[model samples]
Target: MSLAPSGFLNLGAQNLEYRMIGPVPEHAPTIVMLHEGLGSAALWGDFPDRLQAATGAGVFVYSRAGYGASTAVKLPRPLDYMHVEALEVLPKLLEWIDFRRGLLVGHSDGASIAAIYAGGVQDHRVLGLALIAPHFIVEDVSVASIAAIKTAYETTDLRSKLARWHKDIDTAFYGWNGAWLDPKFRNWDISEYLTYIRVPVAILQGVNDEYGTIRQVEIAREECYCPVDVMEIANAGHSPHREAPETTLDAISEFANAVLRDEGFRAA
Candidate 1:
């Protein structure tokens, strides 16, 4: 499928890169995608198109500041950076897009940001969340894997590979890497926000995810009062969307279709 035209969105001091895919009918809801820590709008490849085809919902994706062609940020990002993005940037994005109501498709760090927004923000337009490989709380395995990635970025060809997608590779790498590796970040947890999320949540996780364990899924199920569905795909690692696209797409499509059928949420 051909890609839609791309553009830069100005949100205060930040300029975020965004891409819209599929046909956005006058009344249908849009799927706003949030990339991972090291991911960009380009890195998402054609998954958005596949999603659009599967669910018949317009797909919108954006690269946060410091990633892709968006604005660059300073290194050694704050421990509350994700919170800032969730509370500050996301709201601006929705407004810029003129979002009526839709589902949030977030991955890894992006998922955490989405969760925080769904719970913290009073906007009832957000209908549901499709969280992929989310981390509600810090874990030893997560820290160890992040440390290994830091070593790889410093010694291996990882930086060069990532440079193709990001304008300021260092800002993208260090901004995310440094924050997660900081000792003070160990206490970082968004489980408290789960109690506030009233929409349906579809959690798609990989059984072999190197960064996090099933504890993240357990936390969501235990904390959320909404109907939470979990999909643990085998043989997939960190990114189930990239590793097993068909399964991931099917799960997301099914969930979105169900949401579309809800008469309570009319088309915007």
Candidate 2:
């Protein structure tokens, strides 16, 4: 099916809200962006547009189930939700978009999903990965941060603020929060998938990130046999793309250009 520049993609299970920037995937390499746990297509703001301009590639940003205008998911999400997204939902989304060749650029939960997809799917069309604030394993700091956010959502205006971005705010917030806060989730780890990945990987992390620490990066270095490039953005928190747009964009653009060079792709 032909994807319009911006619309909801009917993927049978659910309809995902999405936006397409620059050329279509058939005309240029695509950059499929996955949002953080609480993030959505609109939450990406103008980053997709900027990324397309910088890389001269198609930028596809989408709101997964229960976020933005997408279908709302059942509450108390499975601890393996990211894996489900990576393995089930994503493959369909990419095929629906007619993705040819591209990189998977994901942030936080999105980043973890990207990693799982690259490692587990063995899809040669996916050339590389750009992971931002990815979590390979559950960390104490991550649990702490997630628990604190649950409190903030209850007591502060964080809920109202996030509501502006998500259509089913409660589902979007609780689905992610509940899963991470679950004690059983502590054993959740995807590092095993790293050893299977065949493409280059770039990790852009915030030095002051509160959700995760440098250990996440260390895991990638330790597990992946492929090239792993890391850039720690100082003074930034979890979301470096929003916190440090220029540096993040330049870094990702450079990575994409280098990876796609064999395909005659260049990012100015």
Candidate 3:
């Protein structure tokens, strides 16, 4: 466990604790794992370790503001939290971590952030990308499933399960669910930005994903001009890495190896 000294990261007017794993000074490319909407670094469990072991790449996993070990926002999150995440917060995180290039393995909302970040880059450090159950635009299935999740949160044992992972589950849940469910959010799309990515990409989408459609990954591939290999894991849910860890990590291992090979740095 090569976890870094966890500490607060000052990002503009906000601060959140960031955790790092693996070797320092970047002897190898890092794969940053961005958590799901309601997820924190703690929720990632052992996936990061598996990825590190397989790829020999140090992993950076952190909870964003208002989730996990990070501090909650003093005020209400704006309706466009995705934009806030992509434009304002993520860049600061990259700078704070002292990395110039690497892979981004994002889940759910974190995937969206990675897309936007890579798309926005000039001389970007992103060597490759892996999006797990990412969403570029909301799909009806997503809206429906999220609505159902909300129902489960109130009426079933889901909240208790979530509470075990999140100290303020409401902050984590509402911050993600409310913004996506909001009608105005339907118009959101990052298709235009994906074209800017020069790195290879791998998109993992479940055929039965709870909150998205296959077309989302298709559009990302098309717009980015890189046909990222899409793996539609049969019977997998929105969290394929959780549902099918071995399958998910196998794809990730392939991408990381390819990237390192392209850069002439074989995995040790």
Candidate 4:
């Protein structure tokens, strides 16, 4: 099925909202973007447009179930929510989008989902990955930051701000927050998946990211036999695409161009 330029994609029991920029997947190499835990398709701001302009590749951004305008999920998401997203949801989404050859560009939880998909699915259509501030394992810093966000959501205007992007604001925020804050989630790990990935990887991390330390990058290097590239963005935090747009765009565009070169993909 040919996807509308921007609309809801009906996948089984849920409808995921998405935006498509540049050429269609069948026309050019696609860059599928997965947003952060608290992020929606709209929360990605203009980064998708900028990425399309920079790389000259089709960019598809989507809101997962329970986020943005997508269907709301049940409260208290499972500890392996990322795994479900990667192993189940993503495969169908790709098939529906007609994703033939492309790179997965994901941020934070989205990045983890991308990594899990790349490692677990073994879909040859996925040529590479551009992961921004991904978490391979839960860390003390990640938990502390999540806990602090919960406080801000309850006491401050954070909820109102996030509500603009998410239709079910509380569901989106708490689903991600609750999972990370759950003590059982401390055992959450996807580092094992890295060993199976056959594509090149580009990891763009913020120098002072509050949610995760450099250890996340270390784990990818130690586990993946595939070529891995790292770029630490200075004066930026966890959301480098938002915090450091130009640098993030340049790095990702360069990587995408290089990996998708065989498909005759180019960068602007």
lDDT of every predicted structure (CA atoms) = 0.89, 0.94, 0.80, 0.94
Cα lDDT of model 1 by residue, 99-146, tens digit: 877799999999999999998995788888999999999999999999
Candidate 4's TM-score: 0.98
For residue 159, model 1's alpha carbon misses the true position, in angstroms, by 1.1
Model 3 scores what on Cα lDDT?
Answer: 0.80
Better of 1 and 2 by TM-score: 2
TM-scores, all models, native as reference: 0.95, 0.98, 0.93, 0.98
Name the TM-score of candidate 3: 0.93
Model 2, 165-200: lDDT tens digits are 998899999999999999999999999999999999
Number of colliding residue pairs in each model: 0, 0, 1, 0
Model 4, 1-268: lDDT tens per residue? 6768899998999999999999998888899999999999999999999889888889999999999999999988988999999999999999999998999999999999999999999899999999999999999999999999999999999999899999999999999999899899999999999999999999999999999999999999999999999999999999998888989999998899888786676654
In candidate 3, stretches whose alpha carbon ends up further than 4 angstroms from where it belongs are: 1-5, 74-76
Clashes of 1: 0
RMSD of each: 2.8, 0.9, 2.2, 0.9
Q: Considering only N, C-alpha and C atoms within 3 Å, which residue pairs clash in candidate 3?
A: 101-125
